[model samples]
Target chain A: MKTSRFALAVCLLFPALAFAHIGQGDIGGGLVAGFKHPILGLDHVIAMVAVGLWGAQLGRPAIWVLPVTFPLVMAFGGILGGLGLPLPGVEIAIALSAVALGLMVAFAARPPLWLAGILVAFFAIFHGHAHGAELPDTANAISYAVGFVVATGLLHALGILIGVAQRWRGGAYALRGGGAVIALGGLFFLASHFSILPGLDA
Target chain B: MNHFNAGFVHPLTAFEHVLAFAAVGLLIGQHGLQKAQFLILIFPLAVALGAAGARALPGLPLVAATNLVSLILFGALTALAKPLPHAALLAFCCAFGLTHGYANGSATTAQTSMLAFAAGLFAATFLVVAYGAAAAQYLLQRKISWIDIAVRVAGSWIAAIGLMALAIGMRGGLGR
Candidate 1:
C-alpha cells in the first residue's frame, strides 16, 4: 500500500515538474520543444489538474465557465507581465495562490461560481503576467501562450472527469483526499518560498 | 538565416511558439473538424500578427503589462460566471500576436521562410492539441484525483511567480 501510495503521489506531481520551461532550450526548436516541456515537468502537469478539480468542486456554470475563463484571462495577464506592468507582491501572491487554492480543495470550500471565477482570475493574472513577462523576445509569443494555456485547461478537465467518480463510492472522499495532497504540496511550496528548502524555486 | 549543424535548423528558434499552439490544441478537447480547422486558421493569423509585432516593437518590459492583466483576470475566472468581453480580448490576441511575430523577425529564417516557420509551428500545435485531447480522454477513464490536486498546487505556484514578477517590475520602475 505504501508503495502504491508513493506511486500515486508521484503521479500527482508528474505534470508540473515535467513542463518547467525555465530551462527551455533554444529559440527555434518550436513545436519539438513545445511538445516536450509538459512531458518533462511536474508543475505544469499538476496545475492543469487543479484547474479541473476546482472547476468540478465549484460545479455548475463554473464547471464550464471558470476553466474557459482562466486561460483567456491568464493569457491577458501574461501579456501584461510581458509588457512590463507594475503589480506588487507577485512571489508572495503566487505562494499564497498555491496555499489558498489547496485549502479550498482540502476544506472543500465551494464559493459561488462568480466568486470562484474571481479567485482563479486573480491568481491567473499573476500566473499569466509572470509567464508573459518572461517570454524571450526570440521566442514566438502566441505559440508560447498556447503551449501553457492549453496544458492548463486540459488538466482542469481531467480533474472534473476524475471528480465524476465522486458520484460513485469513495469518489468525493477521493477528491478530499486529493485536497489533502494539494495541502501538503502547498507546505512544500511554502518551505521552498521561504528559502528554507533545497527546492526548485519554480 | 543562420546555418545550423547537420543541415537542420536549431529547434529552439521557435520553441515557445510550439507551446502556444499545442496549448490551444490541448484545451478544446480536440474534437470535431471545426476545431482543427479553426486552429489551422487562427494559428497562422496569430503568427503573422506576432511576427509583425516583433518587427515593430522590441521591449522586454512589455511582459509587465501582460502579467498584471493575468493576475487581475485569474481572480475573476475562478469565482465568476461572466464571459470576458470577447471582442476586446480577441483584439488583444491579435495585438499580442503581432508582438510575437515582430520580436522574432530577426531570428534564423529564410527571407522567404515565413511559410516554413509557420508550417513548423502548425505541426507542433497539432501535437499538443492531440496530446491534450488524448490525456483528457484518458483521465476520463481513470480513477484518479491526485492529479487534480497536483494541478491546483501548480496553479497556486504560478500565481506566486506572477506576484514576484509584479514586485520586481515595480522595483525596477521605481529605480530603487
Candidate 2:
C-alpha cells in the first residue's frame, strides 16, 4: 500500500472529517445517536485510523481478529461508560489512544499480533467508556453498540486501503514508499492534541 | 409527530446540523470507516456530557456561545479541511456538543421528548453527512478549502439565522 507523498500529505494536514453523537435515555434513539456519534465526530476518527494502521503494520490474523475484537470490547465499554460507571480519564484515554495508535502506524512498528489486538481492545474500552457514559435513556444500549461495531468494521476496510489506496481504486498505498508520509500525517493529530496547531474557525 | 419530534427535529434537521453532519460524511469519504465509526460512537457521549453541562449551568449566553462557537469551528473545519493539529476540534465539539445535547433535551417535553426525536434528528444528521460525502465524492480530489469556502458562506447565513432566532427567542422567551 503505497500512497503519493503529496496527496497523503494533504490529508495529514487536515485530520479529516469525523461525525459522532451520543444521547442518553431513548432506547431506540440512544442506539441511533450512539451509532452516529463515531462517524460524525473527529475524536473517533483518529482512533479508528490507528486501529487499521496498527492492524496493517501487524498483518495477518490480526487483520481479521483485531477489528472484530475492538468493536466487541468497545460495546462493553460503551455500556459501562453510558451507565456512568466510574472510569477516570476516559477522555484522556481516548486522546492518548490516538497518539499511541498513530505512533504505531507512523513507525510501522509491529508488536506481536495478539499484543496488537490487546492494545486495540484496551483502547476500545476507553472509547466505550466515553460512549456508555453518554447513553440516552431511550437508546437500547446493546443495539447502539452493535451499530457502532458494524460501522467500525467498515472503517477498518478504509484503513486497509492504505495497502491498495495509492495506485488506483484500492491500490493507492501498496508500494514501497507508500506509507513514507504516514509519520508526517500522524503529526497533524498529535499536534492537534497538544494545541500546537492554529485554531480551526469552522 | 408530536411536540417532541418538532423540537428535536430542529437541532438535528436544521441546515447547520446538515452541514456539520456533512463534515462527518466527508470524513467517511476522505478518511475511512473505522474513523467514521469512531466519530459515530464517541461524539454523542461527548454531546451528552455537553447536554448535562448545559443543564447544570444554563447560564447566560452559554447556548449562544455554544452555537456560535460550533458554527465558527465547523466553518473553520470546513474551511481548513484538515485534522485539527491539536485539541481545537475536541474542545470545540465538547463545549458545543454538551450544550447542543442539553438543548436537545430541553427542547422536548419529558413525555414526548423521549428517544424518538433523538433518533429522528440523528438519522437526519447522518443522512446529510452521507449525502455531503456523496456530493463531494467527485470533487474529493480537489482541496476541501474550496468546500470550506462554500461552508463558510453558508455559515454566515446560519449566523444570521441564529441571530434572528435569538431575537425571536428573546421576544418569545425560549425556543418554541
Number of the top DockQ candidate: 1
Q: What digit string (tens of lDDT, one per residue) describes model 2 on residues A116-163? A: 878888988888677556655454433354355446655665676554
Docking class of 1: incorrect
TM-score of each: 0.48, 0.40
DockQ by candidate, in order: 0.07, 0.02
Per-residue error for A80 in candidate 1, Å, reads 1.5
Report, to 2 decimal places, the DockQ of model 2: 0.02
lDDT of 1 by residue, A1-202 (tens): 9999998667433322422222232224232333344434444445456667777776665666666567667665765776678677665565566667767776778877778888888887876666656554444333444345555655666778887866755787788778667656756666776788874675
The regions of model 1 sitting more than 4 angstroms off are A1-45, A197-202, B1-176
Give residue A62's error in model 1 in angstroms: 1.1
The Cα RMSD across the true interface for model 1 is 11.6
**Which parts of model 2 are misplaced by more than 4 Å?**
A1-28, A165-202, B1-176
Q: How displaced is residue B67 in candidate 2, in Å?
A: 42
Q: Write the per-residue lDDT of candidate 1 for residues B1-176, one digit (tens) a residue.
A: 21211011222223333333333333222232333334434544664545434434544445424533443333222223223454543454455344444433334234435545544433433455456545633553364744333333333323333333344344344111
Worst 10 residues of 1 chain A by lDDT: A18-27
Per-model chain A TM: 0.74, 0.67
| Winner by TM-score | 1
